[model samples]
Target chain A: MRETESAAEARPYHHGDLRRALIDAARRILETKGPAALSLRAVAREAGVSPAAPYHHFKDKGELLDAVADEGWRILNEAMKAAGENAPSPRAAMPSLGVAYVCFAREHPALYRVMYKRSRDKEALPEHLHEGEDSAYCRTRDTLIAAGADPSDPVGLELATIAAWCAAHGLAEIGGFQQFAHLKEALGGEEAFFRGVFEHMGVFARGLND
Target chain B: MRETESAAEARPYHHGDLRRALIDAARRILETKGPAALSLRAVAREAGVSPAAPYHHFKDKGELLDAVADEGWRILNEAMKAAGENAPSPRAAMPSLGVAYVCFAREHPALYRVMYKRSRDKEALPEHLHEGEDSAYCRTRDTLIAAGADPSDPVGLELATIAAWCAAHGLAEIGGFQQFAHLKEALGGEEAFFRGVFEHMGVFARGLND
Candidate 1:
C-alpha cells in the first residue's frame, strides 16, 4: 500500500510547481502538434499530473490558449527588441528585424498561429498581449527613426515596416523549405527575399521624403 | 404522406446538378453569413437536401472548402480582369485591379480567409485554384507591361505583382472599416485607400524603369 501511494504521489497535482509545469507542457505540445491538438486533459497527462489538475490554473481551454498567445507575444517583443539592440545601423537593423521576424515565425509556427489566428479581444486577451504587440511595433518604428526617417511624418516609416513584416511573415507563413525553394529561384534566396522586402520599405520610406 | 414522399424523392442524390448547386450554395452562405459557419451540412441544408448530398459531390469538408476557395479565386480574377479591360492605360488599370481586389475581400471575408489561410498547399491546390490565381497574376503583369514596365523581366514583374497583391490583400484582410479609416486618413476615404495601394504599385514599377 505504501509503495503504490508513493507511485501515485510522484504524479500528484499539488506537486511544488504544477501550474507552470502545465503551461510548459502545453507550449511543448502546441509547438509540436499545433493548436488543434492542444487539450487540457492531454496537457495534464503530459505534465504527469491528474486529469483535473489543469483547472486549478486555467478556467477553460480558451484561458490556457490565451496564456499561450500572451507568451508568444512576449517572445516576439523580446526578439524584436534584441534585433534592434544588436543592429549596427538603422538600415542594417531594419532587415535584421525582418530576419528575426521570419525566424520567430518559423521556429514557433504553432505559437505564431495561436497569437494571430482568431485572436481573442482585449477583454479576453491576457494582460500582456497589448504591451507585447506595442513593444514589437515600437521597436520597428524607432529603428526606422534611428535610421534617419522623420519622426514627425511617420506614415512612410509605418508603411515600410508593415511591408517588410508582410513580406517576411508572408514567406515564413508559407514555411521554410518550400519558401526557400520558391523564393530562391526567383529572388536569389531568403537573404535576397529580405533585401527585396527591405528595398521596398526603402522606396516607401523615400516616398515620404519626397 | 404521398406529397411529403414526392418532395423527398425530388431531392435526389445527384441533386439535379449538385456540383453547381454546392458552389452556388457555398457562395450564398459565404456572402450572407461568413466563412466560419460554413459546413457541408449547412450547404446541403441551404440547398434543401440531406447532409449526405454534399458527400457525393465532395469527399469531405476540405474538398468543399477547396471548391469554395477555387471559386473565390475565379471571382477575384474576373473582377481584376474587368477592372483592367477598359482602363485609360495599364497604369490606370493597375489601381482599378487593386480596388477590385479590395472589394472582393470586403464582400467575402470568409472566402478571403479560406483563400489565404496558411495551411493550404499550393502544389496540392486544385486545378481551378491555380488557374484562377494565374489569371489574376496575368492581369496585373499585363497591366504593368502596358504601363511601360519591361516585358522581358519576369522577376521584376512577379515582385511588383506580389507587392500589389499584398497591399490589396492586407487591406482586405484587416477588414472594411479599417480600410475606410485608412482611406479617410491617407487618401481621404476608402476610395483613397485603393489609390494609395496603386500609387505605391506605380512607385514600384517606376523603380524598375529607373
Candidate 2:
C-alpha cells in the first residue's frame, strides 16, 4: 500500500467520507483478496486515513465485515425482489429469485462467503440482519402463498421456503464458487439447473393443490 | 485432555492398536470441539504417542480430517443402505435415505459438518471421498431407476439425485441445526415436516407424469 503513496495521498478521508471510503476499500479488498485479507489497518490505509480512523466507525474487523455482509444481504434482497416482480406468476417468481440468488453468489463470492459460510461474529451482523433475512423470506413466502400455499400453517410454508433456499444455496456453492466452477457447465449450467429444480418444485406444488 | 492422562498412559500406542487409537482420539476431539480443535499434537497426546507418530499414519491435519470425514460418509452410506435394504419399494427407499440423512446429521452434527462443510482439500480428499460420494449417489440413483425413471441420461439422474440430496440436507440444516429446532414441536415436528415436503414432491412428480 505504501508503494502507491500518491494514490493514498490523493484520497484523504474527509469528515463525511471516511466511513464510505472504508466500506468501498473493504469491498475492493474483499473482491480482490477475499475476507481473510480484510483488516482494519488495511482498510484505513486504503481510505488514506490514519489507522485509528476506522476504529471511529468500526469497533473491529468483524464489525466491518458484518457491515459488508449486511450490505450484501440488502443488495441481494433488492435483486431478488426486483427479479420476482417481473415474473408472470408467483410460481414463475420462484425461479427468478433462485436465479437471482445464484447470480449474486457468483458475482460476490467473497462477500457471499463472509456473509454465510464463515461463522459470523455477531459484532459484524447487526440487528438489521434479521430484517434483511425476513424481507428476503417474505418475498419467497408471499410467492408460495400466492401460488396456493396456506401461509396459516407455518409448517409447510417454512419447509418449502427453506427447500428452495437450500437448493439455490447449495447450487451456488457447488457451482458459482471457484471450488466447483469446473462442474458448473456440466451441472446443467446455472440457468438450466435452477429452471430444472424450480420446474420439479412446480411439480411438487401440485400436492398443495390436492 | 490432560484430565485423561492416566487413561492415556494406560493404553500405550503400539499395543496392537495405535492406528485405531489415533482415529478414536481424532473423533473424540472433533465431537467435543469441532474441526478447528483437531491437531496432530493434540491427537498424539490423547493417544499417548509421540507428536511425530501421527505423521507416520496421517500426513497432516487436513488429511486427518479427511479421513474422519470419509469415515463419517462410510457410516452415513451404510446407514442409508440399511434404510434401503428393508424398505417396501424403490420409491420408499428414496425417502428412507432422506430420513437417514437427517437422522445422521441430527445425531452427529460435528461429524456431518466435517464431512460436508469443510472445504474439500483435493490433496487430502483422495479417491475415497469420491468413492463414498458415488456410493451415496448410486444408492439413490439406482433406486430412482428401479422406480422406473430413466438413468441412462446423466442429466436426469443428476437432477433427481441432487434434488433429493438438497431436500434432505436442507431439512436437516433447518430442522436440526437452525433455530427451527426450538419450533419443532409447535411446528408439527420433523416427521410432519418431511411428510409435507415429500408429499408435495410426490405431487410434483405426478405432474411430470401427466
Q: Under CAPRI classification, how is model 1 graded?
A: incorrect
C-alpha positional error of residue A108 in candidate 1 after TM-score superposition, expressed in Å: 2.3
Clashing pairs in 2: A66-A124, A203-B204, A204-B204
Runs off by more than 4 Å, candidate 1: A1-3, A15-19, A39-45, A48-56, A120-134, A154-168, A174-182, A185-189, A200-210, B1-14, B118-134, B147-152, B175-188, B197-210
Q: If scored against the real structure, what TM-score would every candidate get? A: 0.78, 0.76
In model 1, the clashing pairs are B183-B189
Evaluated at residue A124, the lDDT of candidate 1 is 29
Interface RMSD of each: 6.9, 6.2
Best prediction by TM-score: 1
Q: Locate the minimum summed-lDDT window of 10 residues in model 2 chain B.
A: B120-129
**Model 1 chain A lDDT-worst window of ten:** A201-210
* Model 1 agreement with the true structure over A44-141: per-residue lDDT tens digits: 88888778877888887767777777788789888877887787765577667767877788678778777766351221223343244357766665
What tens-digit string does per-residue lDDT give for candidate 2 at A1-210?
445557534543355767777889989989988766787888887777788888888877767776777788889888888888887765566567777887898788778877764432221223443354357776776766666666787766666665666556655555432422333467547677655654544322331233
Task: Give the poorly placed runs of model 2, Cα more than 4 Å off.
Answer: A1-26, A35-62, A118-134, A151-154, A176-188, A201-210, B1-20, B39-41, B48-53, B119-134, B177-179, B191-210
